[model samples]
Target chain A: MPRPQPEPVQVVKQRRDAALKAMVEGVPYVQWLGISFDRRGDELTAILSYDEKLIGNPLLPAIHGGVTAAFLEVTAIVELGWSMIWDEVEAKKLEPEDLTAGALRLPKTIDFTVDYLRSGLPRDAYARARVNRLGRRYASVHVEAWQDNRSRLFAQATGHFLMPQRDG
Target chain B: MEDRKATLARQFIEAIPHARALGMDLTELGEGLAEIVMPYADHLVGDPSTGVIHGGAVSTLMDTCCGAAVMSHPSIPAATATIDLRIDYMRAATPGQSLRARAECYHRTRSVAFVRAVAHDDDAERPVATATGAFTIETNGGAT
Candidate 1:
């Protein structure tokens, strides 16, 4: 298929904007998984709500590990914006709205690995992330999620996301 | 279902390194559903700042849970990969509490399966987080 007339950059910008907004409103997966979102500047934080549905037993209910990965992905996407993905002269910066319209998109994950620690219970789960270092070819970031002042960790991950080139 | 549960328990024991590292016990397992828990230890708590548990640590446990559940099925025969996963925070685990997770495979077709899981810290009555995810079950026959 011939490339669409709209600048390739526009494609990304539109998608980027949509992604940003969805990041704010949360996705169906979030609702299904019971994950929530909170944002500040370029930073994003995931908030897990405490409830009966989340518990597995007394003192040791299973913490949904997928939610851990999802939170990290969200933080990474938001952090990507501040990183080198935006540095390309030809790359068009996208707003939260652009992604909502559906310009940018994510690919099927090839593989992911995670290391888990203290499992936090229902009541307090929080994780923060930063882009850290990034390049035109790719970006890398680190994230940490914690629960309570006690800081029982539930999950962590290291992975990659696709970034197709866009026209300036 | 009984056969499936036995298969899940065997797989859980085989898939997760921590199940042994943390001395995990198989609480329960069934068709499209399973629950596992591990003895709590101070070392699992990796966060120095908050003196609580680290998020990545919890995620790892759940990842294995998902992988084990999907891989245990006889029909599907490939390693599973996650598209992405997100978790919300509610409260910290009790200092001496163990971690438990209930995982369920909702929809399954050739190569992809939709899953949901919930984690609790010592109190199954109240969950710390609920998780839903997509797993690409890399089948040998391109079943999907």
Candidate 2:
């Protein structure tokens, strides 16, 4: 048997970028929130751009608690879905264009728990999700969001999702 | 005390920029209880194909309701901020329908308040989602 050839660096980067873009575009809420992703290989950092409409407490001028939760939830869902589709995209079994709006089914949230550590200031917030457990039918993801320093998290969440069934 | 809390609840929602953007209205408020409604909007849709509102939007509604509940609680009449919130999405909210969240502060200590809330559209029998949360009760001064 011949050894399998490794994909070129440029090819790998293009595929990853395409996959991430398609997945993000599929969610309308992500667009409404003006959320963007900074991808470095399989790692993803979700960014929520600062907006006046995101403020919950005018006195403190703090970001809404719900907005923070939404950011963490979106991060977890996207990161989880990307992990599942990475191999298919890399193997050329799935096309990036095919993952466009509603083409790829993202997991449904069963439950989510969020903890607020500090008040979210009026600024851009960043988050990253770690897949704690991924199974065929269920997945658990933990996400942490920070505004200024990554070590100091403003909010964090753990979400359990019901994975979409794969087409036979 | 009851009247004061109700006034506080209304002011609390008014001060929130996102709540105003979502068109959330406070329908009811009492001691340790609050009810808020958010009208359906295209911008809040999670799946364009289904037109279903995003779970994140529902979570926002519930979180705000819980905060209001905490603020109205007799034990913690001062301001409050969310410490932790757990939400269970029972089903997708019906498209083209507004969502209402009712929350109650079931328990409270000197510095913390516990809240439980449910969100629904036209069908209040089956909630679209439910939430339980803990909030910090500010003792020094209200968040005003």
Candidate 3:
């Protein structure tokens, strides 16, 4: 009749660390986008370096709107994939190599919404995603992207992703 | 003049940095409609097990197609920018098949254009994803 206790901090940290490692090393598309994670603090930040190939407008020299959207989406996916903890049995059995080689499935997106607040300049950008809700089969994340000044945001996105089955 | 419009559309699409990166090709252009294609590449795969294309790639395709539609509108603007966009993924796109996006700018005001688009692989009825977006219409030396 009592609620189950939450996972211990150490165990949770270990799983989270493993997930992040897999996200960076295992995913080739993430590498193509030049996305990296900054996990020095409590929050994980997605970083997009300025690339000439990401420009959408030659006139304004602006980053492509779609590229910005893609960057935000990838950020949300990374946030969700890196924080998900597997079941106890699977967690115990997972090795670093297993985690790297598709031990867990990537979350599939159901819907994605992006708002362009300002034109993205041709510069490095940073984004962060926070999970609003995490159900057993679904998760919703809100993400924001900024360049130079955080207050002067470039774009924001909200996404719903279908989570992988935990026990299967 | 029609040929000029087609040339302009192609130039505009090719000028986009992300479109070039994704190897997007402007396949068709009309008064308010545009179609673009993105070939499948291993680097674009999201689910390695299934070899399915990433959702972001689909989003990029739709977004680029939508912008192209806006640019090809009869009352073309000097410049346009995306205001907002929403995409719903219906299903995963079949791997190794190029994705095609068809977009239409259904309505336009003095400063805004509304567009809707769908991305599909082989089956036209079964779309991989769909999108709706608003774009800003900016004129040179004119009101926004």
Candidate 4:
């Protein structure tokens, strides 16, 4: 059964690394998604890790397209939710206890699209994506990868994420 | 055979640019249909719990087979890109020799083509997954 909803949770507007780690640990399956990030200003440069299990074609030693797509999708979700996490922390400034519950909230993924430009080989790989447009109703993000001086786009995925809605 | 696609179907390995590296070959082809196979490896297996092969590999192979089958038409100029691809896993791929995939163009309009495919190791009746995809043919040649 789906969990019951609490009242609409507004953006707290704060930031912390502990919150990020906590969220990452929240979803055990997320480890399989292969995503890591470093923030530079507002943009994020993420290394999309690849494991042997992700391989489809042993002959080419190329990572599978579905894994690439799934990786891109998770990257977008975490990066977008970062802002909401920060917001929640900021709200806690009024009362430290409020921030404690902030880490529990997660972003709602509405929709996303991935465009595959080049294959991500078995060699070292990563992705760089930035939020293109973030509005109340929707958001869009663009991401790609580079290795051995060759710039092959793994994907250009834009998605719609909704904030937590209010409940009685 | 009397099938148009069968006559036109490219030999799985000998026909493509890099089929040898991927261990893929033509399984069968007929009017509005064709199949390709990629030999399995230890790397394809995922967590023992799900025992499922990664979804990404399936999409890539299926996409390649579908596009290749569609481009076989001489006028098509052998160029295609995926507009959208969706895969649904019905069963897990057991560690085996190879994975076989078959695709067909269900409906072809002027600019867009609709294709579907299934992947299985041996038992064709028991498919690992089903895939439906949209392809946009680049008539200007595959270079771009």
lDDT for A36 (candidate 1): 59
Q: What interface RMSD does every candidate have?
A: 14.6, 0.9, 1.1, 8.2
Q: Encode model 1's per-residue lDDT on B4-111: one tens digit a residue.
A: 767757655654433554456666755566677755665554322234544444564565566556655545446666554544344555656777877777778877
Compared with the true structure, all predictions reach lDDT values of: 0.54, 0.89, 0.85, 0.58
For model 4, state the Cα shift of residue B69 in Å: 9.9
Q: Is candidate 2 or candidate 4 better by TM-score?
A: 2
Better of 1 and 2 by TM-score: 2
Scored against the true structure, residue A160 in model 2 reaches a CA lDDT of: 99
**Candidate 4 lDDT, tens digit per residue, A71-120?**
66556666766665555544444234322422344445444445656656
Candidate 3: tens digits of C-alpha lDDT, residues A1-168: 999998887786777666677766566677788888887534789999998988888788898888888899999988887667434323565666666645568788999999999989989999999999988889999999999998889999999999988663
In the range A1-168, model 1's lDDT, one tens digit per residue, is 987676565665555444455433433333433455564533456676665544332334544444455556555554564343334323445554444522333221222344455454556577676655455445556667777653555556654544446556
State which candidate has the highest TM-score.
Answer: 2
State the displacement of the C-alpha of residue A17, model 2, in Å, after optimal TM-score superposition: 1.5
Q: What are the per-model DockQ values? A: 0.06, 0.80, 0.70, 0.13
TM per model?
0.45, 0.93, 0.90, 0.52
Q: Which ten residues in a row have the lowest lDDT in candidate 3 chain A?
A: A85-94
| Candidate 2 runs further than 4 Å off | A1-8, B1-10, B141-144
Worst 10 contiguous positions by lDDT, candidate 2 chain B: B71-80
TM-score of 4: 0.52
Which residues of candidate 3, in runs, are more than 4 Å off?
A: A1-17, A86-93, B1-6
